[model samples]
Target: MNATTQDIEQLGINTVRVLSADAVQKANSGHPGTPMGIAPIGHVLWAHTMNYNPKNPEWPNRDRFILSAGHACMLQYSYLYLTGYDISLDDIKNFRQLHSKAAGHPEYGLVDGVDVTTGPLGQGFANGVGFAIAQKHLAARYNKAGFNLFDYKIYAICSDGDIMEGVTAEAASLAGHLRLGNMIYFYDDNHISIEGDTSLAFDEDVAKRFEAYGWHVQTVADGNDLKALTEAVKNAKEETERPSLIKVRTHIGFGSPNKVDKASAHGSPLGADEVKLVKKNFGFDPEQSFVVPDEVLNYYRGKGDEGVRLEQKWNELYQSYKEKYPELWTEYDLERTGKLPDGWKDKLPVFDPAEGKVATRKASGKVLNAIADSLPGLIGGSADLAPSTDTNLDKYTSFTKDDRSGRNFHFGIREHAMGAALNGIALTKGLIPYGATFLIFSEYMRPPIRLAAIMKVRPIFIYTHDSIGLGEDGTTHQPVEQLISLRSIPNLMVIRPADANETAQAWRVAIEHKDGPVAIVLTRQSIPVIDQSKFAKAIELEKGAYILSDSEKEPDIILIGTGSEVALLIDAQARLKEESIAARVISMPSWELFEKQDAAYKEKVFPKAMKKRLAVEAGSVLGWHKYVTDEGDTIGMTTFGESAPAEDLYKEFGFTTDNVVSRAKALINR
Candidate 1:
């Protein structure tokens, strides 16, 4: 408010703009326009609104900021550097350089202050919703009348590209329906994109759209008006019942003399001449690049240091809270540190083969219910497919607008949004979140699933009705290629458990898995649970591939299978033995996990000396050759399935025991 303070604020904002331009120019790649345009927004957030401790970026209750329009990540990097986060001035200089924390996009674990990895448009927006959901749930579960232990707000800066993406629509709808008041998004309405002006495609009133979604919407006519931006954020904070969107009309390439408001400024860096001009326009020396005035750096750092005192105050209150409610505090301490309760693994269900046939999806449901009480912070639901996917937590109530304490979530029929939101939830410390849909629909969620993999976040993606096993759903719903497709992602662990017992162990692996997302592919039709007494223990599921049943002799052939097909392999192996032929059966649930095993273990599972192999599965045979050597053959669906019964579909797709036996005989002869 004072003259000196106001000058420093303006100087800080300009420094952000200039620094962003320099970084992009240096990298020779990246979107520089939006950062230059939205520097004031960043200035306002750290200096005026957000409560975050740079000294401790892991502070549990600190407000979260997501750069949803992640192409403009230099904006976030500028703020992170200025605010005294672990990001250094040299880090800015090394933007987009190999191994630098300043990645082209804001990566979660790679960067100190970034809350989630965001690159695909609208993912960050949905992630913000997830962050809001986590905050609300944590607050409801832990906060007493005065403690307010988990009242952190979730903030994001989105752009025209993000607003135009369909994921934001689903996420915004869900956020509004849940009445997540902790969410505050700034829509950067620059009206420009890579192709051309947004009017070429998007020209609708964003405010009215958000209003229809039940969000409290406000518009600031200018991005540079710090007072108006601050006022809008203040108004958003006061509305404690609905999520808020403050549309800030920013200018693309705000300070660049020639490139302002042009599509040319959107993706590529402003040229060297334009960069100098931008500096000159912002009252900086045209010759200087990456320049940060001492006053500007000190101003932002001072704002960041305020968070230390705020956290200290919270720490004192937390100590009192501990004394007043020791039991709750114990839970809080455990949850915040992301530690599972002692002996939580013992609560997982162990299925009996005598329980008759059970669908893996149904088995997953039992596992979820069995473990729900033990892991208090685990929460999730389906994309309105809970009944079919069997992903509902049976022992817990649903998480709704009125009750945030419930563990179950109804993510609606929005797979993509649910996928994006799951990333947000997983990024939050102490919370393990899951989402479900049919494996066929997993294609709709590729963006989020792949993003989660790239970030190495562990969000359990439970997809039921894997392959053609769902029956009667026909070709449109049957997922012939889905299994192999999921396996293709680098860091994702794709598991298709064989039976009830294997399904239970798959959930075990899912819960314990870290640093990457897990895709639990399940069948809709019932299948025989492997008798653990006669076969290898289901606990071997962690090894990814194992000998479920073996021949007595140095066997003539090997049969490998996953999920429902594993049962067929078992039946085939028995038939082969009756014919005076020896056969070995291997259960391979996850290719990614198997690849992680040492060479000796891998060789033991699929010995190089015994090369004659046959594999069976009701999905695409894409990646099976790695295990089934060049001398082997695979019986897999190379075409779509029909609307027949699951039994008929299995026979039609060559997924029966007879088919597997025939394939093994042929492979042995070859």
Candidate 2:
């Protein structure tokens, strides 16, 4: 590089540093240290290394960048502004303000060029792994020998907190095992954490740990050495069999006078005096904030133009490939646009009530295999519980290191990593991903599930073993409160289906609902299918709650239930009619979906005249009170389940026709 070019690059890097500090200082609450220290890293990746078009941020083959340490979002915002993305200088000035694009942490849809939300530490790292997986799968499936249609790299800047997180460890292990060569991560090894130096708790050699995980690891002694960082990245790209990690040692507060290498700099801003001193140290105007020299702006915009040209070249190559392989190109286009093939729903199986009883989990497996041939974008796996959760697509081979074209995945006992990886795949545009585990273990993956809800992405979650019905596993495996907990999260639709038909409808809801995440809760034990001929159609499951059977006139009591308990409610209703009493049976499958219905529709399902109501379920009854009135009663488990046969457990827990009839009769008398 020439002397003038080198001077301009340095000026641009310093501009990012000062602008980040100014934003945090003005906000009065933000993390500014890592951004100040890692500005050169961003400058190298965005301006010199990565191929990304700011003019079209959604370019399919462009390299993806994620800031796993999202507290330093000012660094990303400043780079996006400088590189001519949609972010403006005014947006930078409004950091952390209400309704501003510049949130305290990087949010995916709120800001341009941010690949995923990354506030809770290690989720971004796992998300990058998911991105690499999608890239490899697409490349293997679509890229012919002459047509390299999908060859994109995934890059992320992680920190000490990110590395310390166990979720990153799990995701790193999986990435190394899969031999994802397209992933490159930089560890900002600044040694200082919020508490103090990392020695207080974290002292392990992370590079060695990654080396044990089958990754190519390199270390740069100084973070500011741009030449070394660039060379390391090049070497990583050359190693086409393993994921790479470049550990760059850096100072926490690089140019700040008083707060350098101190814990105070990790989150809190360097005060006004120190900010001015830092600018003076960098030879910038001490009085100026958010200043961008004309030369630096022009230099970065030139790099942006280069990105546009690169994308245009790819587009030209794609056009040629389209001509050579017309049908394949059309399929690829559909995948990218998220448009399901016509008649895809025709493949979904509907169960008949006359057929023998079937577990909801087993019914789910049938639905998955039935639709797998039609929906090419559907891909996922269980956390080493495919057989138990009944989530495997038997028609496809398992996704392994040697074969990336398979539709099935073996996430291998990593629930947290699997959740975050699903988020990554959902963000990758072309694919719809799902992950499965026991409903009780959802607690382990709640962070990513909540993130998916917050980002409004569509990642289906198959959580089988819905309640205390999983026999012999006892209290530890039985989920008493999982349903209520999952239902409590806003924008997350939790559907506990009644039988085989409702299970099929639940899968339909999961696939068709694109607004946010959906959790289909299923049962391990067999439950009889409701006869659609005698009752309402199973398609009514979309309305969330519906009256299955009612008396000729206004019912004396209402018996509401979900999942397996609905079968018991049906039996109880029949018995009440034999005794000259009238009762109504309501199938309340999903509270979130039902709440979305209009007030008149809700009133139609639960009439105001029927004040006497009874709710029956094998789980906690925390939220059932909303449907059941003050005079109503709930027959739910008040204690943990015991290790016994499923039938005995149901009887012991009062999940039976007798219990439902008694509860309904008592409510009617009251």
Candidate 3:
């Protein structure tokens, strides 16, 4: 017996809904309404619009899909299962259970088809835009005559809450500006939210608003009409100058007799009676729970076969391209594997201590340019402060979706999207992404940074203008608490280099430490490079901290500082020596790295015998407690910054060498 296309689609859609509802009901928890309401959309996209092989979810050219409204994870899980991925029915049954592959939300490495871990409302929406941006860039960079190697779409399903987020608006605006035609979004206009109809708070014309953002907007009056969804997506694919948003009107709980179209259906599980009634409405046995018809299972199982064939075809095509263009194939393969080309680090500049004072920010640019030569996969841009941040790689062209040959990106003022996009590129496997902005504005990039850390993706963040030394830009631009705040976040390595040489080492750590996210916090003002010949090599930065100055006997006082303030501490140590005060200076670039050091190394750096410890930083003293005991004094800011030159600001804020010396003497006497 043969089945018509309509029969196949209906069976697939109902299967997804039943599986999702059953999974939620079995767990006695979860948002089933969204999966049920959006099953047809998922069905049309996964089975029809998307070019993917569940057997090879990591196919570089496979279209990407993000369930932006990730609270309804059952939708993605059902698709992963039916499409012949590694996910099994038992995985669905164990939804939200500890250690289950089917987590409450989609996590990248945990689930087979999950592109990114996205449960934080609007993050998925923004991350989807980033994925689309990566696709656009890759396509432009590698595609050639008869070698459209990177033509793939990025699709996302967003709910009312996802659209209501501020990041969504920002990301959507950027998507439009970049004209990511391959990016498509389906908005589930189901009316009911967790608090009843979105009418209670959100009633704006979403399609009209998207139009204002330069997106090609469309509306399908009936979301269940798979034909209409297919047509709308077809039109969206043909649009080359804009991203597309399709407002899909859907029922909250389609076919559920008691729960359909109600707010109660949005979050909670329907009762047994309602579940039975819903099954009856779908022409199923009322008493049977989690019952998937043989025909439905057989139909979904066939997807595995279809996916294998698709990947086989792609492999053949890749083989043909390889034979015709061996060099391009080699480059593409190397990039796809995410391995840096040889000698990338050799290009990193080594600063000479003989060259007076140099700001770490300037050194950062030099380091980036050096690494950029070796790391072809490295792509980045700054948030309108590239000149000040010194993050631009010299002579490298800027990457526009229109022209993909450029390695650098220009993110304008969208630090939030820049961070999210960097994650997207990093998720692409073969790309190393970094972004830049002032240290103070890291707050804007914090969410994606946290996600990057959680996902364990190495996306470097070059944050300059680190602390009160930012000077005349004043308190608003100065990052007083930002250092400690970044330090507080788990899995995030915050590195504040003391000088130009340490800046190079910090870059090394950021690139080499692939387990998690790393932020290279640099300074706006110049700092004296410690003479490695006089003391230990800058390579000691890997230990997190090393003594730059020491005495024959146990020091009377110890001075600890990071970034630019380390220079001030060195000067203070000289003054103390003049006064016959024995003081040691320690340059601690990263507290997180230091804490990871062996106990013996830590003790050696800051000896337990030296009870008189003092930390002199130009910012808030929150992070100094561990280094400086409660009995010791911390000479640092307790408040916001003022408008003044960096030198005067240091003097006025009592961060000068004289103040450090005075504080150290006072702490020693106490």
Candidate 4:
């Protein structure tokens, strides 16, 4: 607050602005305005407010920072470089170039200090909500009365575009309802968008809107006022019953004389002459690009050193807590590393076909409940469709504002927010989260699903009502193309389990597969479980596509199916035998998993010599052609289904034993 200290702080803030502008100008393809405008908030939070050690970015209890407006990534890059993080000045110079750490957006794992991969507008905002939920849940489950081991705040800098996104609205509402006191978001109220000023479309009183959502809203008239920004954050932290949103008014381009308040500055570089003028306005050398005065560097590094000391204190506290609660500490450590306890899979229930047929969704519910007691890290719920999705953990209480220790979540009809929040929880490293909804609604939350795949995070998505079998609800509820569409996402494992045992194995795969997101598609109607005693073991599902049953010799024809359609294929196999035509039944549960198999294994499953093949699936037939040769045919729903009983719909849609037999015989004759 003194004159010399204030001068140094101002110098550091300007240094961030100049460096960010230089990176964008050098790249010639980046957003430079918001960084220039929001540099003061960045400097205040990273240098003085947030407790994070750059050297140990993954410290479990460290405060999380997300640049929700990730287009202006140079702002984050400059701060990372200045604060002694692994990001170098040369990396900033190479912004937006191939192989550079400073991508056009802030990618989580690509940079040492970036917490989440954020780009498409409001995703980072929702991700921050996930972080807050993780912190609250961990604090509730692990922290002792005197030991505040899991207490940490989540902060994000959002922009006009971020606020406009519907996902942010959903996440903000949930955060407020949960009373996530650890969340604090700063809105960069520059009033500019890609098209023009927000008045062209957006003109709501954002503060009042958040107040309606149960947030403690505050406004800082000037974005550049560090003291005011600091005080606003302090007050936000003190308010424990609600999340906080601070609207900081700012110019689109803070120092550029001509483009200061223009929409043009929102994305493009300021050009050479304008950049020099802007530097002159900030009392910096016009000739310098990516320059950091030694004093500025030292000042920020000092802050980083302070973070190290804070972490050391936490480490000492954690050691004491470990001694006091050894068993809890062991489980906590395992959760952090994403390691399931030994023999946890032994808890999964195995079903017998003679036990009577069961819907895959019902079987999934039983499997979830059976393993919930052993896998403490497994936690999630449906989008207000828990009973329908059969995703509720019945043994546990609901996760609410009053009790964060409960594992069951009531996501409440917000599929979009549920997807993004799951990503946030997965990113927190101590929990394995899942979200459930009907297969059709996956369309509503595809962005977060794609983001989860991109980030290579583990978040299980349980989508029931898997096909036309979810009948009587008409075409809107039935998912004809959802299976193929989900398969299209790279790194996403889309597993449509054939029956109860297969559903159990899918859950096992989801829990063990940590490289990316997994979707377990289940059925609403009961289908006869394959007799495991006579056919291949259900565990063969991990191979993706396995021969469920085969003839006495090399089959003259092959029958392939997934989900409930597999049962029809098996019945068709029996009927084909009456004509002395040999057939092999292949349960192709997951295309992504199948593609991972070696070429020799793939050839074994669908051999070239046995070109006569028929594929049966009650969904789009687009991707099934690869398994069936050019001489073969596919029996699937080419058109949307009509309202009827599930059995009537299947018979009407040609997803029956007779249809499968006819298709197989036709393929063989061709």
Where is model 1 more than 4 Å wrong at Cα?
536-538
lDDT of 2 by residue, 190-299 (tens): 98899999999999989999999999999999999999999999999999999999999988888998888899999998988889998998888999898999999999
Backbone clash pairs for candidate 4 read none
In angstroms, the error of model 3 at 60 is: 1.3
Model 2: which residue pairs collide?
none
Which tens-of-lDDT digit does each residue in 1-670 have in candidate 3?
2457578669778877777777777777888888899999998887778878887889888889888899889999988888778988888889888899988889988978888988887888889876877777777766778878888888999999999988888889888877778889999989988989899999899999999999999999998998899999999999978999999999987878878899888788876778777787777787776666676767776765677787788788889989998977887798787665677678778899888989999998988887886776777888888899887778788777566667777787888878888888788866778889999999998899999988988889989999888888888999888888899988899899888988988987787787788899998888788776765544678878888878656789889988888888888888998989988888898888999999899899888878789987777889788888776778888999898899888888898888888888888787
Query: What TM-scores do the predictions have?
Result: 0.99, 0.99, 0.95, 0.99
| Model 4, span 285-335: residue lDDT tens | 899888898989998999898889999999999999999999889999998
State the weakest 10-residue window (summed lDDT) of model 2.
531-540
Clash pairs of candidate 1? none
The RMSD of every model to the true structure, in order and in angstroms, is: 1.1, 1.1, 2.0, 1.0
All candidates' lDDT scores? 0.90, 0.91, 0.84, 0.91
Regions of candidate 3 where Cα sits further than 4 Å from its true position = 1-5
